[model samples]
Target: MNCHQAYEALQGLIDNSLNKKELVEIKTHVRNCPACKAEYRALKMVAEGLDRMPLYETSPGFNKEVFRRLGLEYKPQRRPAWQSLAMAAGLSLSVFWLTALAAALPTLLMGAKAYKLTQWLHHPELILPSFQSAILKSGLAAYQTLGFAAKVAGWLLKSSALPTQMAVAGLLALVLVFITMRFFRPQTSL
Candidate 1:
Protein backbone atom coordinates (compact mmCIF):
# COMPACT_ATOMS: atom_id res chain seq x y z
CA MET A 1 0.00 0.00 0.00
CA ASN A 2 3.09 2.26 -0.04
CA CYS A 3 6.38 2.83 -1.92
CA HIS A 4 8.15 0.35 0.40
CA GLN A 5 5.58 -2.48 -0.23
CA ALA A 6 5.71 -1.77 -4.00
CA TYR A 7 9.57 -2.10 -3.95
CA GLU A 8 9.32 -5.45 -2.07
CA ALA A 9 6.60 -6.76 -4.50
CA LEU A 10 8.35 -5.46 -7.66
CA GLN A 11 10.22 -8.73 -8.26
CA GLY A 12 7.08 -10.88 -7.83
CA LEU A 13 5.11 -8.54 -10.10
CA ILE A 14 7.75 -8.63 -12.88
CA ASP A 15 7.82 -12.43 -12.61
CA ASN A 16 3.95 -12.40 -13.04
CA SER A 17 3.45 -14.48 -9.88
CA LEU A 18 1.91 -11.86 -7.53
CA ASN A 19 -1.41 -12.82 -5.85
CA LYS A 20 -4.56 -10.99 -7.04
CA LYS A 21 -5.02 -8.92 -3.84
CA GLU A 22 -1.27 -8.06 -3.70
CA LEU A 23 -1.31 -7.16 -7.43
CA VAL A 24 -4.28 -4.89 -6.94
CA GLU A 25 -2.68 -3.18 -3.92
CA ILE A 26 0.61 -2.70 -5.78
CA LYS A 27 -1.12 -1.28 -8.83
CA THR A 28 -3.14 1.16 -6.73
CA HIS A 29 -0.04 2.32 -4.85
CA VAL A 30 2.06 2.64 -8.03
CA ARG A 31 -0.68 4.65 -9.73
CA ASN A 32 -0.72 7.23 -6.94
CA CYS A 33 3.06 7.19 -6.10
CA PRO A 34 5.68 8.32 -8.61
CA ALA A 35 8.65 6.90 -6.66
CA CYS A 36 7.11 3.39 -6.45
CA LYS A 37 6.16 3.49 -10.18
CA ALA A 38 9.79 4.23 -11.09
CA GLU A 39 11.11 1.47 -8.82
CA TYR A 40 8.69 -1.08 -10.41
CA ARG A 41 9.87 -0.08 -13.88
CA ALA A 42 13.55 -0.49 -12.84
CA LEU A 43 12.91 -3.95 -11.41
CA LYS A 44 11.05 -5.02 -14.59
CA MET A 45 13.94 -3.75 -16.73
CA VAL A 46 16.51 -5.68 -14.64
CA ALA A 47 14.50 -8.92 -14.95
CA GLU A 48 14.08 -8.42 -18.71
CA GLY A 49 17.79 -7.72 -19.14
CA LEU A 50 18.68 -10.91 -17.27
CA ASP A 51 16.26 -12.94 -19.36
CA ARG A 52 17.73 -11.48 -22.60
CA MET A 53 21.34 -12.49 -21.70
CA PRO A 54 22.75 -15.52 -23.55
CA LEU A 55 23.00 -18.80 -21.60
CA TYR A 56 26.23 -20.86 -21.79
CA GLU A 57 26.16 -24.56 -22.74
CA THR A 58 28.50 -27.14 -21.12
CA SER A 59 30.84 -29.19 -23.43
CA PRO A 60 30.15 -32.89 -24.02
CA GLY A 61 32.38 -35.53 -22.24
CA PHE A 62 32.94 -33.14 -19.29
CA ASN A 63 31.72 -35.68 -16.66
CA LYS A 64 33.64 -38.57 -18.25
CA GLU A 65 36.89 -36.52 -18.25
CA VAL A 66 36.40 -35.60 -14.56
CA PHE A 67 35.76 -39.24 -13.58
CA ARG A 68 38.78 -40.44 -15.59
CA ARG A 69 41.09 -37.96 -13.81
CA LEU A 70 39.66 -39.09 -10.41
CA GLY A 71 40.54 -42.75 -11.25
CA LEU A 72 36.98 -43.88 -10.54
CA GLU A 73 37.17 -46.86 -12.94
CA TYR A 74 40.95 -47.49 -12.68
CA LYS A 75 42.40 -50.53 -10.86
CA PRO A 76 45.23 -49.90 -8.39
CA GLN A 77 48.71 -51.13 -9.41
CA ARG A 78 50.32 -53.44 -6.86
CA ARG A 79 54.01 -54.05 -6.17
CA PRO A 80 55.44 -57.29 -7.58
CA ALA A 81 55.04 -60.28 -5.18
CA TRP A 82 58.79 -61.03 -5.23
CA GLN A 83 59.59 -57.40 -4.26
CA SER A 84 57.27 -57.61 -1.21
CA LEU A 85 58.77 -60.95 -0.15
CA ALA A 86 62.33 -59.61 -0.52
CA MET A 87 61.51 -56.55 1.60
CA ALA A 88 60.02 -58.72 4.36
CA ALA A 89 63.03 -61.09 4.30
CA GLY A 90 65.48 -58.16 4.44
CA LEU A 91 63.65 -56.60 7.39
CA SER A 92 63.59 -59.90 9.27
CA LEU A 93 67.30 -60.52 8.64
CA SER A 94 68.21 -56.99 9.82
CA VAL A 95 66.17 -57.42 13.01
CA PHE A 96 67.64 -60.86 13.76
CA TRP A 97 71.21 -59.65 13.15
CA LEU A 98 70.63 -56.59 15.35
CA THR A 99 69.28 -58.71 18.25
CA ALA A 100 72.09 -61.32 17.92
CA LEU A 101 74.76 -58.58 17.85
CA ALA A 102 73.23 -56.91 20.92
CA ALA A 103 73.18 -60.24 22.78
CA ALA A 104 76.85 -61.01 21.88
CA LEU A 105 78.31 -57.53 22.62
CA PRO A 106 77.85 -57.64 26.43
CA THR A 107 79.33 -61.15 26.70
CA LEU A 108 82.31 -60.25 24.51
CA LEU A 109 83.05 -57.08 26.52
CA MET A 110 82.67 -58.93 29.83
CA GLY A 111 85.11 -61.66 28.70
CA ALA A 112 87.70 -59.08 27.58
CA LYS A 113 87.39 -57.20 30.88
CA ALA A 114 87.68 -60.47 32.84
CA TYR A 115 90.89 -61.37 30.98
CA LYS A 116 92.39 -57.92 31.80
CA LEU A 117 91.35 -58.23 35.48
CA THR A 118 92.95 -61.69 35.75
CA GLN A 119 96.21 -60.42 34.18
CA TRP A 120 96.27 -57.41 36.54
CA LEU A 121 95.69 -59.66 39.60
CA HIS A 122 98.49 -61.94 38.48
CA HIS A 123 100.98 -59.01 38.09
CA PRO A 124 102.10 -57.63 41.45
CA GLU A 125 103.68 -54.54 39.78
CA LEU A 126 100.30 -53.31 38.40
CA ILE A 127 98.41 -53.80 41.72
CA LEU A 128 98.50 -50.47 43.63
CA PRO A 129 96.78 -48.71 46.61
CA SER A 130 94.67 -46.64 44.16
CA PHE A 131 93.12 -49.86 42.78
CA GLN A 132 92.04 -50.90 46.29
CA SER A 133 90.56 -47.41 46.91
CA ALA A 134 88.66 -47.57 43.62
CA ILE A 135 87.28 -51.01 44.48
CA LEU A 136 86.07 -49.74 47.90
CA LYS A 137 84.37 -46.74 46.31
CA SER A 138 82.63 -48.94 43.73
CA GLY A 139 81.34 -51.29 46.45
CA LEU A 140 79.99 -48.33 48.45
CA ALA A 141 78.26 -47.04 45.28
CA ALA A 142 76.65 -50.44 44.66
CA TYR A 143 75.30 -50.57 48.24
CA GLN A 144 73.84 -47.05 47.93
CA THR A 145 72.29 -47.90 44.57
CA LEU A 146 70.69 -51.08 45.96
CA GLY A 147 69.24 -49.18 48.97
CA PHE A 148 67.69 -46.52 46.66
CA ALA A 149 66.28 -49.19 44.33
CA ALA A 150 64.71 -51.07 47.24
CA LYS A 151 63.04 -47.88 48.52
CA VAL A 152 61.60 -47.17 45.08
CA ALA A 153 60.37 -50.75 44.71
CA GLY A 154 58.74 -50.72 48.19
CA TRP A 155 56.92 -47.46 47.45
CA LEU A 156 55.74 -48.69 44.02
CA LEU A 157 54.45 -51.99 45.47
CA LYS A 158 52.41 -50.23 48.22
CA SER A 159 50.85 -47.68 45.81
CA SER A 160 50.14 -50.21 43.04
CA ALA A 161 48.17 -52.60 45.32
CA LEU A 162 46.08 -49.73 46.78
CA PRO A 163 44.72 -48.52 43.41
CA THR A 164 43.82 -52.04 42.25
CA GLN A 165 42.17 -52.89 45.60
CA MET A 166 40.06 -49.73 45.56
CA ALA A 167 39.06 -50.31 41.92
CA VAL A 168 37.98 -53.90 42.59
CA ALA A 169 35.94 -52.87 45.68
CA GLY A 170 34.19 -50.11 43.76
CA LEU A 171 33.41 -52.50 40.86
CA LEU A 172 32.01 -55.08 43.28
CA ALA A 173 29.77 -52.45 44.93
CA LEU A 174 28.47 -51.35 41.51
CA VAL A 175 27.71 -54.93 40.54
CA LEU A 176 25.87 -55.59 43.81
CA VAL A 177 23.77 -52.45 43.40
CA PHE A 178 22.97 -53.40 39.80
CA ILE A 179 21.89 -56.92 40.83
CA THR A 180 19.76 -55.63 43.76
CA MET A 181 17.99 -53.16 41.49
CA ARG A 182 17.41 -55.79 38.83
CA PHE A 183 15.96 -58.49 41.16
CA PHE A 184 14.41 -56.63 44.14
CA ARG A 185 13.07 -53.42 42.64
CA PRO A 186 9.33 -53.30 41.83
CA GLN A 187 8.08 -52.70 38.29
CA THR A 188 5.76 -49.73 37.76
CA SER A 189 2.76 -50.11 35.42
CA LEU A 190 2.50 -47.57 32.66
Candidate 2:
Protein backbone atom coordinates (compact mmCIF):
# COMPACT_ATOMS: atom_id res chain seq x y z
CA MET A 1 0.00 0.00 0.00
CA ASN A 2 3.02 2.30 0.16
CA CYS A 3 3.80 4.73 -2.69
CA HIS A 4 6.60 2.43 -4.00
CA GLN A 5 4.42 -0.66 -3.91
CA ALA A 6 1.60 1.28 -5.57
CA TYR A 7 3.98 2.36 -8.37
CA GLU A 8 5.22 -1.21 -8.80
CA ALA A 9 1.67 -2.56 -9.17
CA LEU A 10 0.48 0.17 -11.58
CA GLN A 11 1.51 -1.80 -14.68
CA GLY A 12 0.01 -4.99 -13.25
CA LEU A 13 -3.25 -3.12 -12.57
CA ILE A 14 -3.39 -2.01 -16.24
CA ASP A 15 -2.50 -5.53 -17.46
CA ASN A 16 -5.07 -7.23 -15.17
CA SER A 17 -2.36 -9.51 -13.78
CA LEU A 18 -2.40 -8.53 -10.09
CA ASN A 19 -4.33 -10.95 -7.82
CA LYS A 20 -7.59 -9.88 -6.14
CA LYS A 21 -6.16 -8.88 -2.75
CA GLU A 22 -3.19 -7.12 -4.31
CA LEU A 23 -5.44 -5.40 -6.87
CA VAL A 24 -7.70 -4.06 -4.14
CA GLU A 25 -4.78 -2.85 -1.98
CA ILE A 26 -3.06 -1.14 -4.91
CA LYS A 27 -6.31 0.42 -6.13
CA THR A 28 -7.03 1.77 -2.68
CA HIS A 29 -3.54 3.22 -2.45
CA VAL A 30 -3.86 4.85 -5.89
CA ARG A 31 -7.19 6.38 -4.88
CA ASN A 32 -5.66 7.94 -1.76
CA CYS A 33 -2.24 8.99 -3.09
CA PRO A 34 -2.14 11.87 -5.61
CA ALA A 35 1.20 10.93 -7.22
CA CYS A 36 0.18 7.26 -7.67
CA LYS A 37 -3.19 8.36 -9.07
CA ALA A 38 -1.50 10.53 -11.72
CA GLU A 39 0.95 7.70 -12.63
CA TYR A 40 -1.89 5.21 -12.87
CA ARG A 41 -3.89 7.56 -15.05
CA ALA A 42 -0.92 8.06 -17.39
CA LEU A 43 -0.26 4.28 -17.65
CA LYS A 44 -3.95 3.53 -18.14
CA MET A 45 -4.24 6.14 -20.94
CA VAL A 46 -1.10 4.72 -22.70
CA ALA A 47 -2.47 1.21 -22.37
CA GLU A 48 -5.86 2.25 -23.75
CA GLY A 49 -4.19 4.05 -26.65
CA LEU A 50 -2.12 0.93 -27.43
CA ASP A 51 -5.27 -1.21 -27.26
CA ARG A 52 -7.00 1.13 -29.72
CA MET A 53 -4.16 0.85 -32.25
CA PRO A 54 -5.05 -1.12 -35.43
CA LEU A 55 -3.76 -4.67 -35.82
CA TYR A 56 -1.67 -5.49 -38.92
CA GLU A 57 -1.25 -8.89 -40.54
CA THR A 58 2.29 -10.12 -41.06
CA SER A 59 3.55 -12.49 -43.82
CA PRO A 60 3.97 -16.16 -42.90
CA GLY A 61 7.72 -15.90 -43.28
CA PHE A 62 7.93 -12.99 -40.78
CA ASN A 63 9.47 -15.23 -38.12
CA LYS A 64 12.00 -16.64 -40.61
CA GLU A 65 12.73 -13.12 -41.85
CA VAL A 66 13.37 -11.92 -38.33
CA PHE A 67 15.58 -14.91 -37.60
CA ARG A 68 17.46 -14.40 -40.84
CA ARG A 69 18.10 -10.79 -40.01
CA LEU A 70 19.42 -11.87 -36.60
CA GLY A 71 21.66 -14.48 -38.32
CA LEU A 72 20.01 -17.40 -36.51
CA GLU A 73 17.83 -20.39 -37.43
CA TYR A 74 14.46 -20.79 -35.67
CA LYS A 75 14.29 -24.22 -34.21
CA PRO A 76 11.82 -24.59 -31.36
CA GLN A 77 13.02 -26.39 -28.23
CA ARG A 78 11.96 -30.03 -28.01
CA ARG A 79 11.39 -31.56 -24.54
CA PRO A 80 12.54 -35.15 -23.85
CA ALA A 81 9.75 -37.71 -23.38
CA TRP A 82 11.06 -38.94 -20.00
CA GLN A 83 11.34 -35.37 -18.68
CA SER A 84 7.58 -35.04 -18.00
CA LEU A 85 7.29 -38.54 -16.53
CA ALA A 86 10.26 -37.92 -14.21
CA MET A 87 8.80 -34.58 -13.13
CA ALA A 88 5.41 -36.18 -12.35
CA ALA A 89 7.05 -39.03 -10.40
CA GLY A 90 9.25 -36.54 -8.51
CA LEU A 91 6.21 -34.45 -7.56
CA SER A 92 4.34 -37.56 -6.30
CA LEU A 93 7.32 -38.67 -4.19
CA SER A 94 7.71 -35.13 -2.82
CA VAL A 95 4.07 -35.08 -1.76
CA PHE A 96 4.42 -38.47 -0.06
CA TRP A 97 7.57 -37.39 1.81
CA LEU A 98 5.94 -34.13 2.89
CA THR A 99 2.88 -36.00 4.22
CA ALA A 100 5.06 -38.53 6.03
CA LEU A 101 7.12 -35.75 7.59
CA ALA A 102 3.95 -33.98 8.76
CA ALA A 103 2.66 -37.17 10.43
CA ALA A 104 5.96 -38.06 12.13
CA LEU A 105 6.63 -34.46 13.25
CA PRO A 106 4.66 -34.85 16.48
CA THR A 107 6.37 -38.12 17.35
CA LEU A 108 9.78 -36.65 16.52
CA LEU A 109 9.33 -33.45 18.57
CA MET A 110 7.67 -34.97 21.64
CA GLY A 111 7.38 -38.54 22.83
CA ALA A 112 4.01 -40.19 22.22
CA LYS A 113 2.75 -42.22 25.20
CA ALA A 114 0.49 -45.26 25.56
CA TYR A 115 1.77 -48.13 23.41
CA LYS A 116 -1.88 -48.67 22.43
CA LEU A 117 -1.72 -45.52 20.30
CA THR A 118 0.90 -47.09 17.98
CA GLN A 119 -0.13 -50.71 18.42
CA TRP A 120 -1.89 -50.94 15.07
CA LEU A 121 1.41 -50.28 13.27
CA HIS A 122 2.97 -53.33 14.99
CA HIS A 123 0.23 -56.06 14.94
CA PRO A 124 0.13 -56.01 11.10
CA GLU A 125 -2.24 -58.81 10.12
CA LEU A 126 -0.20 -60.20 7.26
CA ILE A 127 -2.73 -62.87 6.21
CA LEU A 128 -5.55 -63.22 8.74
CA PRO A 129 -6.63 -62.92 12.37
CA SER A 130 -9.05 -65.08 14.36
CA PHE A 131 -12.65 -63.92 14.72
CA GLN A 132 -13.91 -63.52 18.28
CA SER A 133 -17.16 -65.47 18.05
CA ALA A 134 -20.07 -63.54 19.36
CA ILE A 135 -20.39 -63.89 15.67
CA LEU A 136 -22.81 -65.58 13.28
CA LYS A 137 -19.74 -66.59 11.29
CA SER A 138 -19.92 -69.82 9.25
CA GLY A 139 -16.69 -69.62 7.29
CA LEU A 140 -13.21 -70.21 8.62
CA ALA A 141 -10.42 -67.89 7.35
CA ALA A 142 -6.74 -68.72 6.89
CA TYR A 143 -5.34 -67.73 10.30
CA GLN A 144 -4.84 -71.44 11.02
CA THR A 145 -5.68 -73.16 7.73
CA LEU A 146 -4.35 -76.62 8.56
CA GLY A 147 -6.01 -76.65 11.99
CA PHE A 148 -9.35 -75.70 10.42
CA ALA A 149 -9.00 -78.52 7.88
CA ALA A 150 -8.50 -80.96 10.77
CA LYS A 151 -11.57 -79.51 12.50
CA VAL A 152 -13.59 -80.00 9.32
CA ALA A 153 -12.42 -83.62 9.04
CA GLY A 154 -13.39 -84.34 12.66
CA TRP A 155 -16.80 -82.77 12.03
CA LEU A 156 -17.34 -84.91 8.92
CA LEU A 157 -16.58 -88.12 10.88
CA LYS A 158 -18.96 -87.14 13.71
CA SER A 159 -21.83 -85.93 11.54
CA SER A 160 -21.83 -88.46 8.63
CA ALA A 161 -21.17 -92.19 8.09
CA LEU A 162 -17.46 -93.13 8.02
CA PRO A 163 -17.54 -94.85 4.62
CA THR A 164 -18.95 -91.92 2.66
CA GLN A 165 -16.41 -89.36 3.93
CA MET A 166 -13.61 -91.97 3.70
CA ALA A 167 -14.40 -92.69 0.06
CA VAL A 168 -14.13 -89.05 -0.90
CA ALA A 169 -11.06 -88.59 1.28
CA GLY A 170 -9.49 -91.65 -0.26
CA LEU A 171 -9.89 -90.34 -3.79
CA LEU A 172 -8.70 -86.85 -2.97
CA ALA A 173 -5.79 -88.08 -0.88
CA LEU A 174 -4.32 -90.27 -3.63
CA VAL A 175 -1.33 -88.05 -4.45
CA LEU A 176 -0.93 -86.79 -0.86
CA VAL A 177 -1.05 -90.35 0.57
CA PHE A 178 1.45 -91.61 -2.02
CA ILE A 179 3.87 -88.79 -1.25
CA THR A 180 3.66 -89.38 2.48
CA MET A 181 3.73 -93.19 2.40
CA ARG A 182 6.55 -93.43 -0.19
CA PHE A 183 8.67 -90.58 1.13
CA PHE A 184 8.50 -91.63 4.80
CA ARG A 185 8.51 -95.45 4.28
CA PRO A 186 12.26 -95.54 4.93
CA GLN A 187 12.04 -93.72 8.28
CA THR A 188 9.10 -95.87 9.34
CA SER A 189 11.11 -99.05 8.53
CA LEU A 190 13.80 -98.03 11.03
Candidate 3:
Protein backbone atom coordinates (compact mmCIF):
# COMPACT_ATOMS: atom_id res chain seq x y z
CA MET A 1 0.00 0.00 0.00
CA ASN A 2 1.10 3.62 -0.59
CA CYS A 3 2.17 5.81 2.34
CA HIS A 4 -1.07 7.83 2.26
CA GLN A 5 -3.27 4.67 2.22
CA ALA A 6 -1.21 3.09 4.97
CA TYR A 7 -1.40 6.24 7.08
CA GLU A 8 -5.15 6.36 6.64
CA ALA A 9 -5.43 2.69 7.75
CA LEU A 10 -3.06 3.16 10.71
CA GLN A 11 -5.90 3.71 13.20
CA GLY A 12 -7.70 0.54 12.05
CA LEU A 13 -4.39 -1.30 12.24
CA ILE A 14 -3.75 -0.10 15.83
CA ASP A 15 -7.27 -1.09 16.86
CA ASN A 16 -6.83 -4.55 15.26
CA SER A 17 -9.81 -3.87 12.96
CA LEU A 18 -7.94 -4.53 9.68
CA ASN A 19 -8.15 -8.00 8.00
CA LYS A 20 -5.09 -10.30 7.99
CA LYS A 21 -4.04 -9.33 4.43
CA GLU A 22 -4.44 -5.56 5.10
CA LEU A 23 -2.58 -5.92 8.37
CA VAL A 24 0.32 -7.65 6.65
CA GLU A 25 0.47 -4.97 3.97
CA ILE A 26 0.45 -2.13 6.55
CA LYS A 27 3.02 -3.88 8.70
CA THR A 28 5.34 -4.35 5.72
CA HIS A 29 4.93 -0.68 4.75
CA VAL A 30 5.61 0.52 8.33
CA ARG A 31 8.64 -1.75 8.60
CA ASN A 32 10.11 -0.45 5.30
CA CYS A 33 9.28 3.25 5.54
CA PRO A 34 11.09 5.24 8.27
CA ALA A 35 8.56 8.14 8.06
CA CYS A 36 5.58 5.79 8.27
CA LYS A 37 7.23 3.89 11.13
CA ALA A 38 7.77 7.15 13.08
CA GLU A 39 4.15 8.21 12.53
CA TYR A 40 2.86 4.76 13.58
CA ARG A 41 4.95 4.83 16.76
CA ALA A 42 3.73 8.33 17.68
CA LEU A 43 0.09 7.42 17.09
CA LYS A 44 0.48 4.16 19.08
CA MET A 45 2.08 6.05 22.00
CA VAL A 46 -0.77 8.62 22.05
CA ALA A 47 -3.42 5.88 22.03
CA GLU A 48 -1.71 4.01 24.87
CA GLY A 49 -1.28 7.20 26.94
CA LEU A 50 -4.92 8.08 26.46
CA ASP A 51 -6.05 4.61 27.49
CA ARG A 52 -3.89 4.72 30.63
CA MET A 53 -4.93 8.25 31.70
CA PRO A 54 -7.13 8.63 34.76
CA LEU A 55 -10.92 9.09 34.31
CA TYR A 56 -12.29 12.36 35.66
CA GLU A 57 -15.37 12.68 37.90
CA THR A 58 -17.22 16.00 38.20
CA SER A 59 -18.46 17.31 41.58
CA PRO A 60 -22.16 17.08 42.39
CA GLY A 61 -24.30 19.88 40.82
CA PHE A 62 -21.40 20.80 38.53
CA ASN A 63 -23.66 21.43 35.56
CA LYS A 64 -26.07 23.50 37.67
CA GLU A 65 -23.19 25.58 39.02
CA VAL A 66 -21.78 26.08 35.52
CA PHE A 67 -25.15 27.21 34.20
CA ARG A 68 -25.59 29.53 37.19
CA ARG A 69 -22.22 31.13 36.50
CA LEU A 70 -23.25 31.61 32.88
CA GLY A 71 -26.46 33.36 34.03
CA LEU A 72 -28.66 30.73 32.40
CA GLU A 73 -30.20 29.09 35.49
CA TYR A 74 -33.98 29.57 35.50
CA LYS A 75 -36.12 29.75 38.63
CA PRO A 76 -39.88 30.26 38.53
CA GLN A 77 -41.85 32.07 41.22
CA ARG A 78 -45.19 30.90 42.60
CA ARG A 79 -48.08 33.26 43.29
CA PRO A 80 -51.22 32.83 45.32
CA ALA A 81 -54.27 31.53 43.41
CA TRP A 82 -56.48 34.45 44.49
CA GLN A 83 -53.93 37.01 43.26
CA SER A 84 -53.70 35.28 39.89
CA LEU A 85 -57.48 35.19 39.57
CA ALA A 86 -57.78 38.86 40.46
CA MET A 87 -55.14 39.84 37.90
CA ALA A 88 -56.92 37.89 35.19
CA ALA A 89 -60.26 39.47 36.08
CA GLY A 90 -58.79 42.95 36.04
CA LEU A 91 -57.21 42.36 32.61
CA SER A 92 -60.47 41.01 31.19
CA LEU A 93 -62.50 43.94 32.53
CA SER A 94 -60.00 46.47 31.16
CA VAL A 95 -60.14 44.89 27.72
CA PHE A 96 -63.94 44.87 27.79
CA TRP A 97 -64.16 48.55 28.80
CA LEU A 98 -61.66 49.55 26.06
CA THR A 99 -63.60 47.67 23.40
CA ALA A 100 -66.91 49.20 24.49
CA LEU A 101 -65.43 52.69 24.46
CA ALA A 102 -63.94 52.14 20.98
CA ALA A 103 -67.26 50.91 19.60
CA ALA A 104 -69.11 53.95 21.02
CA LEU A 105 -66.37 56.47 20.10
CA PRO A 106 -67.97 57.94 16.94
CA THR A 107 -71.30 58.58 18.64
CA LEU A 108 -69.66 60.00 21.70
CA LEU A 109 -67.58 62.44 19.63
CA MET A 110 -70.48 63.52 17.49
CA GLY A 111 -72.71 64.13 20.53
CA ALA A 112 -70.23 66.70 21.91
CA LYS A 113 -72.24 66.71 25.19
CA ALA A 114 -70.83 65.90 28.59
CA TYR A 115 -72.89 64.51 31.49
CA LYS A 116 -72.13 64.87 35.20
CA LEU A 117 -72.04 61.76 37.37
CA THR A 118 -74.81 63.07 39.62
CA GLN A 119 -77.05 64.00 36.67
CA TRP A 120 -76.50 60.59 34.99
CA LEU A 121 -77.20 58.84 38.26
CA HIS A 122 -80.35 60.93 38.99
CA HIS A 123 -81.83 61.00 35.46
CA PRO A 124 -80.24 58.75 32.83
CA GLU A 125 -83.23 59.51 30.53
CA LEU A 126 -82.02 63.08 30.02
CA ILE A 127 -78.82 61.85 28.27
CA LEU A 128 -80.59 59.57 25.76
CA PRO A 129 -81.96 62.22 23.33
CA SER A 130 -78.58 63.87 22.54
CA PHE A 131 -76.83 60.47 22.37
CA GLN A 132 -79.49 59.04 20.01
CA SER A 133 -79.28 62.06 17.68
CA ALA A 134 -75.48 61.81 17.56
CA ILE A 135 -75.64 58.06 16.79
CA LEU A 136 -78.15 58.65 13.96
CA LYS A 137 -76.01 61.36 12.31
CA SER A 138 -72.84 59.29 12.58
CA GLY A 139 -74.57 56.17 11.20
CA LEU A 140 -75.84 58.04 8.16
CA ALA A 141 -72.33 59.44 7.48
CA ALA A 142 -70.79 55.99 7.79
CA TYR A 143 -73.40 54.49 5.42
CA GLN A 144 -72.75 57.08 2.76
CA THR A 145 -68.97 56.66 2.98
CA LEU A 146 -69.33 52.88 2.79
CA GLY A 147 -71.45 53.12 -0.35
CA PHE A 148 -68.85 55.38 -2.04
CA ALA A 149 -66.03 53.01 -1.06
CA ALA A 150 -67.99 50.04 -2.45
CA LYS A 151 -68.53 51.80 -5.75
CA VAL A 152 -64.80 52.58 -6.09
CA ALA A 153 -63.92 48.96 -5.23
CA GLY A 154 -66.48 47.62 -7.73
CA TRP A 155 -65.12 49.85 -10.49
CA LEU A 156 -61.54 48.73 -9.89
CA LEU A 157 -62.52 45.05 -9.79
CA LYS A 158 -64.52 45.35 -13.02
CA SER A 159 -61.92 47.40 -14.92
CA SER A 160 -58.83 45.27 -14.04
CA ALA A 161 -57.81 41.79 -15.23
CA LEU A 162 -58.95 39.80 -12.23
CA PRO A 163 -57.11 36.51 -12.94
CA THR A 164 -53.85 38.18 -13.88
CA GLN A 165 -53.99 40.47 -10.85
CA MET A 166 -54.72 37.54 -8.55
CA ALA A 167 -51.84 35.50 -10.01
CA VAL A 168 -49.40 38.40 -9.59
CA ALA A 169 -50.60 38.96 -6.02
CA GLY A 170 -50.16 35.26 -5.23
CA LEU A 171 -46.63 35.31 -6.66
CA LEU A 172 -45.75 38.42 -4.63
CA ALA A 173 -47.17 36.85 -1.46
CA LEU A 174 -45.15 33.65 -2.10
CA VAL A 175 -41.99 35.64 -2.65
CA LEU A 176 -42.56 37.51 0.62
CA VAL A 177 -43.11 34.22 2.48
CA PHE A 178 -39.91 32.80 1.02
CA ILE A 179 -37.96 35.95 1.90
CA THR A 180 -39.27 35.94 5.48
CA MET A 181 -38.47 32.23 5.89
CA ARG A 182 -34.95 32.72 4.56
CA PHE A 183 -34.42 35.66 6.89
CA PHE A 184 -35.72 33.88 10.00
CA ARG A 185 -34.47 30.31 9.39
CA PRO A 186 -31.92 29.04 11.89
CA GLN A 187 -28.28 28.86 10.82
CA THR A 188 -26.40 25.53 11.02
CA SER A 189 -22.70 24.74 11.16
CA LEU A 190 -21.17 23.50 7.91
| Top model number, TM-score | 1
Off by over 4 Å in 2: 58-190
Ranking by TM-score: 1, 3, 2
Q: What is the TM-score of each candidate against the true structure?
A: 0.34, 0.30, 0.31
In terms of lDDT, the best-performing candidate is 3
Task: Name the regions of candidate 1 deviating beyond 4 angstroms.
Answer: 70-190
Model 3 regions lying over 4 Å from their true place: 60-190
User: Model 1 Cα RMSD, Å?
Assistant: 29.5
lDDT of 1 by residue, 1-190 (tens): 7676678887778888899999998888888889988888888888889987665545555676777999877444578898677666655444433333333333245754643554433333355577775654444444334334434545755653423433343343454445444443344332
The 10 consecutive residues of candidate 1 with the worst lDDT sum are 98-107
lDDT winner, 1 or 3? 3
User: Global CA lDDT of candidate 3, please?
Assistant: 0.60
| Predicted structure 3, TM vs. truth | 0.31
How far residue 144's Cα lies from its native spot in candidate 3, in Å, is 99
* Residue range 112-188, candidate 2, lDDT tens digits: 45323644433344333534221102111221232344346657667444334333443434534444444323321
Candidates sorted by lDDT, best first: 3, 1, 2
Please report how far candidate 2 places residue 65 from its true position, in Å. Answer: 13
Worst ten in a row by lDDT for model 2? 134-143
